[model samples]
Target: MDDLFAPATGAWQRVSPRLATVRRIVIAAIAAPVVIAGIVLAVLLPDQRWIGAAVTVATLPLAAWGGVWAGHNQRTWGYVENADDLLVTRGVMFKRLVAIPYGRMQFVDVQAGPLARAFGIATVTLHTASTETAADIPGLPSDEATRLRNRLTELGESRGAGL
Candidate 1:
C-alpha cells in the first residue's frame, strides 16, 4: 500500500506552514458554533443539560484533534514540476499522487476565498481533458500560486496542449 508514491524521489516543494493556520481557523470556526449551541442549550433547557455537556465535551476534543490534523495534513502535501508533467501528492493513510502532463492540461485556475485571502494562501486547480483527472492543490502562498499558474499555462502552451 505504501509503495504507490515514492515520496522521496524529487525535490518536492512544500506549501507554506501558514496553511495549517488557515485550516485550524476553519476548524475552530466550525467547532465554536457547536460548542456555543451546546452552551446555549444548557442555559435554556436545564433538564437536557447532559446533552449540552456531552456536545461541548465531544466538540472540544474533536476540534483540538482537527487542529493537530491540519498541521500534519498540511505537511503531507507537496508538488514537483517534472520535465514533462506536474506531480502532486497528498493524503496520509489513503495517499494519492496526481501526475498531470503539460500537454493534457486544458486550463489552470487559482482561487482564494475571503478567509484564505486574509491568510495569504490560495488553491490551484488543474483541469484536463478528463474530468476524473482534475485536481486541486491548496494552501499555496498567494504569490507562488500565481507563479505556478503562469508557469503551467506557459508550459501547456509550449507543449502544444492548445489551451
Candidate 2:
C-alpha cells in the first residue's frame, strides 16, 4: 500500500501551498453576480416559479460542491523531477496527473491576483509543447512560486542542453 502511493525516484515535492481563504473569497466574489441573478430569477419570474426555484436551489449545492472540489483539488501541488521527465498531479475526484519531459517545456509563468496578494499567495502556470495542456499550480507563496519557477527553468534548460 505504501509503495502504491510512494513516489518513484525523484519523487514529487509539494512546492505550493493550498489555496487560501482569500482565494476562495475571490472566487465567491466573482460568482456573486450569477448568484444574484439566480435569486432574482427565482423571485421575479412569476410564470416559471418552479423552474426558477429549482435553479436557485441548485446553485446552493453547486456552490458547495465547487468550493469543496477546489479545496480538495488544490490541496496538493506535486512536482516530481525524474531523470527524464516532470510529473504533476492534482485534483481530488477528477484527478489529473501530467507528465512533461524537460524538453517539452515552453515557459513558465507566475501570477498573483489582488486577493492572492492580500494573502501573499501566487499561482504558477507551466506551458508545455501542447497549447491546451498547461499546468496551473495555484496558491503558493509569492517567494516560493518564484523560486520554484527559477529552479524548474534551470532544470529544463540544463536538460535541453544535455540533449
Candidate 3:
C-alpha cells in the first residue's frame, strides 16, 4: 500500500531548486553594494571616525539580515498535484500547508515582479472560497505556473459545473 503511493508522493516532492523570491535577492544584492560603500567612506573619513564607526556597526545588522533573507530564499515548498486536490507548503518560521480542493477553487493567478521576470520565475496564487485558506506557491517557472493555473481552473470549473 505504501509503495502504491510512492510515485504520487515523489511527484509532489519534486520542487524547483531555486524558489527564493527575487525581491529577497534584489534587496540583499542592493544592500551589499550600499554597505560596502558606507564602510569605505567611513574608513576614509578621519575626523568623523565616531560617525564612521556607527555606520560600520549598523552594517553588521544589515549583513545578518541579508544572511537570513538568503536562507529563506533558498527554502521553498513545492506544489503537490494529487488526484483530487492541490497542496502547497512553505515557510521556515511559520510553516504553512494549504490544500485547495478542486471544487472550492475559484481562480488561480500567476504573479511576476520585475526581478521575477528577470529570473524567469513566477508565483502561483490560488484563491478558493475560503479567504483564510488561500495558497501562494512561489518559485515556479513561468510556464509551469501558467500550466498549473490552467489545469486547476479547468478542474475547478468542471467540478463546479457538475454541481
Candidate 4:
C-alpha cells in the first residue's frame, strides 16, 4: 500500500518543485475571494449573518484540504521517455500509469495560464488519434515544456512515418 504510487525504478523525471507553490496560490486565489465575499455578505446582511458565517467556516477546511491535496498531487506526477513510448504516472490513492507510443501521437500543445506563467511553469498536452488516448503533463518549467512539445512532435512524426 505504501509503495502503490512510487516512481518506477528508472529515469523518471519529476516536474518543477515550484508547482506546489503554484497549486497553493491557485487554491488560495479561488478560496480567499469566496470566503471574503461570504464575510462581507454577513456584515452587510445581519439577518443572514449566520448563514454567511457558516459558509465561511465550512469553506476554510475545504480550502485547506484542497491546498494539501494539490501539493500531494503535484508530488505524485512524473514522466519517463523510453525508446518506444512515453510513460506518465500519477495519483496518490487511485494510481494511474499511461504509456503513450510515440508513433501514435498526432500533435502536442503547450499551455501556460496566468498563474502558471507567473510560476514559470507550463503544461504539455499530447493529442493522439483517439481522445481517450490523450495525455497531459503539467508543472514543467516553461523552457522544458516547450522543448518537450517540440521533441514529442518530431518523434511522433518520425516514428509514425513507418506506421
Clashing pairs in 1: none
Work out the TM-score per prediction: 0.93, 0.73, 0.73, 0.89
Top of the candidates by TM-score: 1
Residue-level lDDT tens digits of model 1 in 1-163: 6566764457779888988999899999999999999999888889989989999999999999999999889998989898889989898777888889999999999999998999899999999999877788899999999999999999999999867
**Regions of model 1 farther than 4 Å from truth:** 1-3, 7-9
lDDT of 2 by residue, 48-142 (tens): 87766776677667777767766666665676767776677775545567777777777888898877887788888888868656687777788
Better of 1 and 4 by lDDT: 1
The parts of candidate 4 lying over 4 Å away from their true place are 1-9, 161-163
Worst 10 residues of 4 by lDDT: 2-11
Residues 1-163, model 4: lDDT tens digits: 6455444556678899888889888789888998998899899999889977988998899999988898899888889888888888878788787788899987888999998998899999888888777788999999999888878988988896222
Q: Using lDDT as the measure, name the better of candidate 1 and candidate 3.
A: 1
Error of 3 at 72 (Å): 4.6
Worst 10 residues of 1 by lDDT: 1-10
lDDT of 2: 0.71
